[model samples]
Target: MDFSHWLLLFCTLLAFYNLGIIWFGQIVVYPLFAKVGAEEYITYHTFYSSQIPLPVILPGFAHFLLPIALIFYRPEPVSLGLALANAACGLLSLVVTVALEIPRHNRLEKGGKQEDVIRELIRYNWPRTFSIMGSAFLTLMMLMQAFSPTI
Candidate 1:
């Protein structure tokens, strides 16, 4: 119930939540992009973008930062290494989101749902999705390690 503990709980919760989203996105959401009508695509994409920031961005950014904080404050080498891995994954996800996915979404908004673009988005998203799951695994490992008895 210290700061590091709080941060760990928050990061762990968020990481799992993001893992759920990642699966849903890869399996359901992104695939449906092609089905939206060209005229309505922008509106749909706009609404999606508008709504996702809170659930997605807030936790994601927090998760990214939490690991670094843990590294400094907790300083348990095993958990710290896991935290670093989580942070690295989180950072890569953010970079991919901003650099690749968002622009693709924007293009889809303007140009209307191109199959190629949609396919590209889906293709490009695999790394970020896997990264989030990896982060979740690391977060879980860190939490378990923190709670377990030390030999």
Candidate 2:
């Protein structure tokens, strides 16, 4: 009904959007990397890498800003601790992306379909996937708390 609520909704939407993408990557896409024949992997990976960034960067950039905004402008009933917790979940996703997952993606892109790399990609991906999932839940809870009228 107001700016804080809107902020929470937008942040929640971004978290859910990222949650869907990451889960799909976790459950379907990453594991399937090994099945692609080596010769075709580069091409497949190229296409995948190209297509992925828009989905990632658009929300990612806003996702970055929104959590910081949450820290400052959290709605009624969304405590400072809850806001910080939501931001931490977002931070975890970012740290995992910048530190772990991106390198593995680049390795697969450059080195072709190394099974070890794919396996590590899948293995390393669990944290980001679940954190975004956690982010989504945190945002939802924030919304419910903001909107609900007592008990």
Question: Over the stretch 107-136, how does candidate 1's per-residue lDDT look in tens digits?
Answer: 987887688999999999999999888989
Error of 1 at 123 (Å): 0.7
Candidate 2 per-residue lDDT over residues 97-121, each given as its tens digit: 8899889999999989999999999
Off by over 4 Å in 2: none
- In candidate 2, the residue pairs with backbone N, CA or C atoms under 3 Å apart (3 or more residues apart, or in different chains) clash, namely none
| lDDT values for all models | 0.81, 0.85
Report residue 42 deviation for candidate 1 (angstroms). 1.7
Supply candidate 2's per-residue lDDT for 7: 88
Error of 1 at 31 (Å): 0.6
In candidate 1, which residue pairs get closer than 3 Å at backbone N, Cα or C atoms, i.e. clash? none
Stretches > 4 Å off in candidate 1: 75-78
